[model samples]
Target chain A: MSVLRKIWTALRGSARELGDAVVDANSIRIFEQEIRDAQAAIDDSKRALTGVMADKMKIDRRLAELNDLIADDEASAVKALEQDNEALALEVAQRIAKREAERKEQFEIAERLASQIASLRQKIDAAEKIIADHQRELSIVRTTESVQKATVQIVDNIAAQDSTLSSARSSLERIKARQQRLDDRLAAGEVLARESGEQALDEKLKAAGIKGEAADANAILARLRARAES
Target chain B: MSLLQDMTLSLANTVFEGHRFDCLPISGEQEVLQVQVSGLEEMPIYVTVTDTQILCISYLFKKSELKEGSINELNALLLELSLPMPLSSFGMVGDRYVIYGALALTATAEHVMKELTTLASNAVDALQTLEPYLK
Candidate 1:
């Protein structure tokens, strides 16, 4: 009976430890998703920044060429006007002035465009930094999670060990209970035999003005029965 | 006219209160004018001065959008310095005016209010420096 009880106790302990392990596994999955989302956002910002910079460079170069042409044309018109070629001077001056006006307009347009480009670049840079910061945060979170999981696993192992010890302890208690019950029955039988043997002695002692047994055998038997029932 | 000095004095007036400007001293012949605004969040306002006007080329703020009242204050300030409201004909690319201000994004009254304030402040400060050049 003791051997059968030990086997049942071991099975129950294993089942309880397995339940704890399943719970720990689920928590790790949630941490992994958070990391993935952070990484995706960082990638998107990088792509957008790259496209913006490329376009800005092209516009800048175009503006620079326009600026150089305006300068060259104005200088030529001045030189032509100084040479006393009235008709040629007027045409050159007018053409240079028109181009200069166009260049000025283009310059203003370019300046505003450049300002907008710079602002966007700043935002992209800030976003990129934020993403990097989040990545670092994710790393720390993941590391902490891993350590927690390890700790849980160690705790679970300790719990499993404790469960086995508890099972062994319970089996011992059951055995002790069984032994106590058997001992009570033996004691009852001995008491009955002693009572029968002492019946003659009791009648003899009654003449000497003393009771045969001071202790109540029936009361002791009742106590043993109550203990066994409990 | 030294473009650098003109811009620096303008920026100094806009950012620093009660700072008397003697004259803008030119450091070198460069397109970029770097103005240092001293504070916990030290902002560097960059300016590019041209023949016609001074453009607040770029400025950096942490993450918040600019507010409209702030923009109005900036415009008023720039008006005091004779700088006009920056034209929107400027195309945006990266952290350019449009993107940083979220100009291309869905426009709400609140959003516009926020963006305009910062933009106006930056433009006014930038144009203040260019005022001499513009005249």
Candidate 2:
């Protein structure tokens, strides 16, 4: 039995993993499918539950009629006995006994239907909760996937933009040139002063590189400082 | 007084509080201060003292040197935070993006220190935030 249980557990775990993979790879599609599935389940459960409730209502109506008939039969039998009509009284007594049997049957039916209605309501509640949880998980998964995609795209864009950024450096150079043209005060001879402003940081980064691999910004920064202090 | 002049005075005053910095001889016409921020490692910042503004820049990694496709996330984050960051912004310096702060020349020692501190702290935070994305 234990070995059988172990196999069952393993199967369940594998099935869960397979489901997770499907959800991860096609989260939106899975989410929509999940919504559709949950709605269908809810509809089915509602139908079943509605049938149970309708049975309960029908039994309750019959029980009410039986109760009224029981009261009328007792009153009529009592009146016949008081009038000294034994035959009439006995006939009423027979009808009263038959109704008593019917009332018992109707009562039993009502009780059973009531119990069924309660059980169905509980099942529906549980199913609804499961559906809600599925929807919540789907939302969170979609959000996380979006963030990951956006991150990848942004990195690719910048890597691709490296050449265009050199254009930016030239634009900066132009801005500096224009500034030089405007002021015409600071000697252009101090070219290193302006260009080095940008390149100093560049050189420092290059110094921190490990075999052309991008070094951590923090590590490169530390190296630059160590060089400065030395 | 010139922008560099006030910066020199503030540096002498140790106004940047705990951060380390040194004067730089341009390799040009603009006098610059190099500030070293200590975090998980030492980070380099180039401070250019212009006639109008003081630009404090911390050099990040080179775009060319990073493994292909590693920078998309970092770029996305920078783009997202650029506008919301009131004190500093990311700019391309050569092939690298540097986090920098711009301050008015007439700004007081207290103000300069604040700007420098914010820019440095943010750069460190950014490095940590982007560490996972780095290849």
Candidate 3:
């Protein structure tokens, strides 16, 4: 990819990450806002429907008035025709035709408005149902998100505690080994000191007749060797 | 003129300076007039006029208007305010919840207007308290 394309891709990825974070943070608020907005839209749809219906009613009334005017004028036209006043009959017929034409136009407009209002109402109703479903889904996910986050944090804490416990156990073993080594070395030094002290005491005792070697060939050999060396 | 018609004319002459008084279009043994109040938020109140008394009823809301999830809460709120509402108490007509007040036909026009206004006000008040459940 070109450098610009790569940069654009990175920006898109970051934007998605940011969007995910925002959704995670404000999921409930966004859902509530959607509900509010949907309700407002529904209300607007209802108001528009009401206005259109009013217009249709007005048109219907006008059509009714036109019908009455046409009927009266037609009656007058028939009377004039019977009276042999062709000019008056023609004028009345023309007036009735004009009224009829206006009525037809108003009726068509009213029918169109009625249809538009019906279509709009259906669309708004569908939107409300969809928003309601979204709200239900969001509520369920909210609980799941809370519990999921809590459990994840708990797992992380336990993992951290396990590491600390492992180090503590290893430290305990190392300390115990050091203690045992110290104890062993001290024991060996004590044994040597005890043996040397006993030997020195034995020599003193032999000279002073308190402690002495065994009276055997080894003692004679040791005396002869000492005399020879002297 | 009929007793109800006389009562209505007297009512219009006495209390309602500019209120629209139209007879209800029901073929029954009784004469009823619908009183459209002079405010945008107020709904039209219906008065059943008999030989002896006038019962004015104003619609509060429909059972269908009550949200299913908040029905219990709305019912509880209705029960809470059932006894303490001023002038008029909550009543039901089929599936419609209403508020109403009654007066003898012999009652003064002021008394009639008071009862009608009381019913309307109570319905409006109940709607305000139960708005959340309504939505």
Best by TM-score: 2
- Fnat values, candidates in order: 0.00, 0.00, 0.00
Off by over 4 Å in 3: A1-23, A142-230, B1-135
Pairs in steric clash, model 3: none
Quick one: best DockQ, which candidate? Answer: 2
lDDT, candidate 3, A83-110, per-residue tens: 9999999999889888888988988998
TM-score of chain B of each: 0.33, 0.78, 0.78
Error of 1 at B31 (Å): 58
Model 3 CA lDDT for position A37: 85
Tens digits of per-residue lDDT for model 1, B11-60: 44442332222222213333444333322111223333433333332232
| Docking outcome class, model 3 | incorrect
- Stretches of candidate 1 exceeding 4 Å from the true structure: A1-48, A155-230, B1-135
| Residue-pair clashes per candidate | 17, 11, 0
lDDT of 2 by residue, B91-125 (tens): 65334566778777687877877777778677666
Interface RMSD of each: 32.9, 18.1, 32.9
**Candidate 2 TM-score versus the reference:** 0.39
> Which rank order by TM-score, best down to worst?
2, 3, 1
Please, what is the TM-score per model?
A: 0.31, 0.39, 0.33
Q: CA lDDT, every prediction?
A: 0.44, 0.61, 0.62
